[model samples]
Target chain A: MAKKILIKKASGEKEIFSIIKLKKSMMSSGVASGVAKRVISQIRPKIKPGTTTAQIHRLAFDLLKSEDKSYAARYNLKKAIMRLGPDGFPFEKYFAALLEEQGYETKTNVIVRGKCISHEVDVIAEKYEKNIHAIIEAKFHSHGGGKTGSKDALYTYARFLDIKEAWNIKKNKGAKPREATLQSWLVTNTKVTGEVKIYCGCVGIKAIGWDYASEGDNLQELIENRGLYPITVLISLNHQQVRDLLHHNIVLCKQLINQDTLLSRLGFHGRQIQQLYQEINKLFGS
Target chain B: MAKKILIKKASGEKEIFSIIKLKKSMMSSGVASGVAKRVISQIRPKIKPGTTTAQIHRLAFDLLKSEDKSYAARYNLKKAIMRLGPDGFPFEKYFAALLEEQGYETKTNVIVRGKCISHEVDVIAEKYEKNIHAIIEAKFHSHGGGKTGSKDALYTYARFLDIKEAWNIKKNKGAKPREATLQSWLVTNTKVTGEVKIYCGCVGIKAIGWDYASEGDNLQELIENRGLYPITVLISLNHQQVRDLLHHNIVLCKQLINQDTLLSRLGFHGRQIQQLYQEINKLFGS
Candidate 1:
């Protein structure tokens, strides 16, 4: 216990376990700061060198579950989002829904004209009174750990500028076009690198990643607090069935419940549908 | 021969043979239009259903070889370019050299600042007196049969937009900045599609691909006419040796010939270097 314990990270690097960092991460997951401190103290006695971060994560997850289901769910936010896709499309649709919830009207896969080229934007968001529109490039890496880096940030910022140029040109052409500011955003399920953070900051790009809690509600908070668990989060729905639901553009659990008929349409039997709904309700109340 | 012949395209799509299309393609390879028509008429009897476009290309190539080595080299231009990369970096350097030849100072893999982010541009070229600078995205597909499509076009355009925004900001900040204009270009060593053509034209992107002979010398003409055959075009060099040379940024055969020391530096023995030079001299005069 007196010795500093070295724990393995997901990226295979080893670092000393720090109570401050662990507590801050838990707090981001909606656990009270006091609760995180208490949980870490309890695990302090069992701590050993060479323990993987995953094992530490497992212990934290179990303790949070024992505390409350919602606490556990919030702590599990990243893993839940990771279940969203092996591709970025479903994540784009889901992110558009998130933007919609923020009172911004959103469109997915909108082809915007640019000065030097046209761009098939992943998602475009607008809130007229705010006079701000956003061009978001949603990057979702599935079922594992990979941080969104500077490349995504640069490209996302680039797309936003192109669209903004076209927007300004159109405005100049119109007799009385409404004023709107264009914003660039990079949304991702995974964490972001320091380079991404610095570059995004330098360029005025609003980047949101899973554990990005620098300001406002990050992607994790938005999903966890809103209970916007994707259909893939339902234990009853297998990967194929989840894929089918996503294919039908029904990503959220709430969306799935309303379209029980889609379950049948996607070739699921009655018992499977019932179980899915039952799990959905248990995970997220009807 | 009495009926119209069906030719299979590289993409596995079937189409009817058109003498006009074939002749135009040949003319783009530096064959005179009149000679193209004559060659087509000469091969008219050999036209039959189910012949691949590749077979037709072979016939034309053989005829060109018999006529002149330069014509054969022009005809083999696309195939030569295809060997330039299994990666794009070498092509970036080669394209930068091309820009240099056009009286523009050039750099490869430059990080340009942007309004919203910084971009690692593939190639950048400037002619200050001309008051214009170009940002080029050099796309090279390895060994054959892929294309520069809309996705690439959109992203390349996006990167340019971001860099241009940054460029303008820097220009405005300078006490006596040159009144240079920024332009975006996408240069590929493969064929382009109708979508790429239309979108580029619509958005003012200067899209140049392998067969893009609408106006000024296209990629084929630039390489063949200038005798800038890539080091990959040397049959004497195997893939590993070519890759090693590419790693050292010796892409053009001219670059290779000038740096015979580089061949030995890459661990090639005396005879291998001699044979490579022999092939280079035969393919493109030293």
Candidate 2:
């Protein structure tokens, strides 16, 4: 009924401010509906043309923190996902785990054979019974300010086509199962450019970014849907602790909860552990 | 034969120190054969297994400079190529000029149409009589440290394929000449990896780095063969002067020499201008 506010994104692109998207994120953060509405009402008057999404986020975060600090931490999921990488290995491993949960046998950091040459694949995920096989390329840009675009999509597809040709040859030679359908996937922590989506679609590559919707949930939604919140999502865990936890391969809060002893090795004291458990329970458990 | 000395290249790869390569570079620098042989003999005792190419370059360069100052500038051709870029437009223009010397009608920074999207092509070179139409992709690294690899080859090929498909469609409709063969050309100021050469070969793309040979003289050899050395090759010019000269589209030393009035605009006084002309004459002519 009103003119939609244009908000500047971290990548310097303008996006329409959607109350529906905001409320969904708030609800996912465990904010009560009443509080989300109240926050939106407070934020409404401040909304003007060219107000940055970052400024809106800070305003929402401060408001959420005042209401519930733990909820505010949950709201900072996207930022925490960014903390999982500088080198991108942690993000790759975490995404591999997510695929593993979806009944795919996943391997991280694989050297896969291609038609042209050898390719260092990030994640090779296969579901034998369903005849679904995939090589997933994970691109993790730390801080999430950069947009992933067609170059990434194109190169990943280039690698995919090379490998796919080899796979087809292997299948004909009886090296691979005839029924296996090989697919290429590109996953990124950053938002996808429009060109990326178009290019990926044109090439029959399934691409997923934090905001790119291919056939299913984007990375953020997938995390929420699967309850596979990364240990980085815990605001109380500092950079060192998160690094140490990922070093032990305890990526998800779900995995860390099962291995309580691992938290001590990460320098979490008894009280801190109790608080983490409480936060984890609130975020994931009943 | 003595054990071939291992030298670390700028890309951190170990290479065999070739006397032939050194000699050829010296010959190109206008150094006499007797002097080149003497310089090599003097430098041989200093050569260690793990000596960097940078050190060897310095050794050879000092020897050449002692022999002739103007010749040293020509010997530093590769380094001059590096100075032609921070933004890369100068190198692109310089390269376009080199192509034009070969009788190719060239345009720089043209936005070309593709099937799926439009591409901002660096250089479009056409020789209608030969039915050779090309879109040249130029990659200019300010420092000659990074290695151009398969990713560049693959992505450049990808863009080429997209545009090539569109060109075919246009040709079918008689929009383009039926006999015109669309070629994709990638040129870079850095050394290309073996993988890039291999990949480009497989994809039918002509990739030429400073050293990656694709059936013709690479960028350095092409520049020398054409006598179209960049004005950056002039040691008398400072960084600001080079930038200003490039801004005015005076890319080649030959171009700059013809426009002597432009030298005064770049703050080179009468004596300095005469010296520059002498250096240019020595580098290009008898």
Clashing pairs in 1: none
**What DockQ do you compute for every candidate structure?**
0.26, 0.53
Alpha-carbon lDDT, every model: 0.76, 0.84
Q: Write the per-residue lDDT of candidate 1 for residues B53-139, one digit (tens) a residue.
A: 888888887776666555555666677676666667878888888777778899999887777666778998888888768888888
lDDT for A201 in candidate 1 is 80
DockQ of structure 2? 0.53
Top candidate, metric TM-score: 2
TM-score of the candidate numbered 2?
A: 0.88
Q: What TM-score, over all chains together, does every model reach?
A: 0.74, 0.88
**RMSD, each candidate, Å?**
5.6, 3.9
True contacts kept of each: 0.36, 0.39
Error of 2 at B87 (Å): 1.3
lDDT by residue for model 1 (A140-200), tens: 8985558898767766765677677878888888833456677888888888998788778
